[model samples]
Target: MTTALTLTAAPGPDGVIVLTAAGEIDMSNAEAFAEALTSAVTGATGSRLIVDLTEVHYLDSAGLAALFAQADQIELRTGPLLAPLLEVSGLAELTTVHQA
Candidate 1:
């Protein structure tokens, strides 16, 4: 079943693009997540895109794959609980990850 996911892309301070996501990110909604990331990345001007996953409770391989696809164009901000997943997946190595 598909879970509830909220994606909001907005401009942050210093002309940064911020995509704030909330809820579970699994196979069911990974495509939508990927599309949002793509849209945010493509629409980004000259600044970096920050993907905030602090409120995301769960993420699966599909979700990770989506993030990996845009690793070069986005940074990640997540809570302590999800930090290890990002690190273990090697996504942190490819892109910046901030634990909050």
Candidate 2:
């Protein structure tokens, strides 16, 4: 099993990119994950950002907020942020209904 949460990012066709994260996200690594998302969004423009959390088995409020913050960052950059996929296995109560 993967010992650490792996955050992988790759650009898709038409400037669209997917940031795929797996494993557990909590306070310890939340900031790093958030920074990663922030960097990804900041590095690109006028593209669609899709964060795929299908492999993410667990999450917390910090993680959820970090993800949403990425969405906001993308939008502020004029990048079209796609609907996030929180997957089926994981669950979290967040102000962002789009997450649920």
Candidate 3:
């Protein structure tokens, strides 16, 4: 069964695109997450893409992979709970990760 996940997109300061994700992100909903991210990126009016993961309670490998697929074009803002995991997974190197 697919887990509940919510994605919101909006324009940030200085023309940046911010994509906020809430709820859990796992294999069941990774594809949806990817599509949302892709849409946000494609429709963005700026070169910077910020993915806010502060409200996300959980994320699995599949979700991580989806993010990684767009790592080159995105920056990530994460909560303390997922900071270490992102670092250990080397995602921090692939993209900018701001820990909160």
lDDT of 1: 0.95
Residue-level lDDT of model 1, residues 72-96, one tens digit each, is 9999999998999998989999999
Cα lDDT listed for each candidate: 0.95, 0.60, 0.93
* Model 3 TM-score, all chains together: 0.94
Candidate 2, residues 1-100, lDDT tens digits: the string is 3237898878867567767787888787898889888877766667656666666777767776686655443321111122233333132222222331
TM-score of each: 0.96, 0.66, 0.94
Residue-pair clashes per prediction, in order, are 0, 0, 0
C-alpha RMSD values across all candidates? 0.8, 7.5, 1.2
Candidate 2 segments exceeding 4 Å error: 1-3, 73-100
> 1 or 2: which has the higher TM-score?
1
Residue pairs that clash (backbone atoms under 3 angstroms), model 2: none
Single out the weakest 10-residue window by summed lDDT for candidate 3.
40-49
